[model samples]
Target: GATPSIDRFDPDLTIRGLLEIWRRNASLKD
Candidate 1:
């Protein structure tokens, strides 16, 4: 099922997603 566009605007989810990406990048830098 396609996720609703409104979910992208959620602050908590957005922050979590950004944190996940940042963690991945940080790990790769090590």
Candidate 2:
């Protein structure tokens, strides 16, 4: 059996975090 791993600092995670941050900021500005 293989265990899945979570990478908090992965590039994908960072990109997603930035996207979410931008989305929230954009919503606040609207």
Candidate 3:
């Protein structure tokens, strides 16, 4: 079986990383 990425074990960090990526994308649309 394949192992999941570390982010799956640390949801807060995953959410934060996602938010950061979303912010960058939002800024790019401006």
Candidate 4:
């Protein structure tokens, strides 16, 4: 996965990375 596991990264970083990926994918679909 593009994002690191929660065990590797802080919770905030993991969440931010996931959200970033989601935004990128959403943009691509537009």
lDDT of 1 by residue, 1-30 (tens): 346664757788888888999999999999
Q: TM-score, each model?
A: 0.68, 0.69, 0.74, 0.73
lDDT of prediction 3 = 0.80
Among all windows of ten consecutive residues in candidate 1, which has the lowest summed lDDT? 1-10
Clashing pairs in 3: none
Full candidate order by TM-score, most accurate first: 3, 4, 2, 1
- On residues 1-30, what C-alpha lDDT tens digit does candidate 4 reach at each position? 743555787889878988999999999999
Candidate 3, residue 14: the lDDT equals 76
RMSD of each: 3.2, 6.0, 3.1, 3.4
Cα displacement (angstroms), candidate 2, residue 28, comes to 0.3
* lDDT, candidate 3, 1-30, per-residue tens: 223776356788878878999999999999
Say what the RMSD of model 4 is: 3.4
- Which residue pairs come into collision in candidate 2? none
Candidate 4 segments whose C-alpha is farther than 4 A from its true place? 1-6
Cα lDDT of model 2 by residue, 1-30, tens digit: 222444436778878978999999999999
Which regions of candidate 1 deviate over 4 angstroms? Answer: 1-8
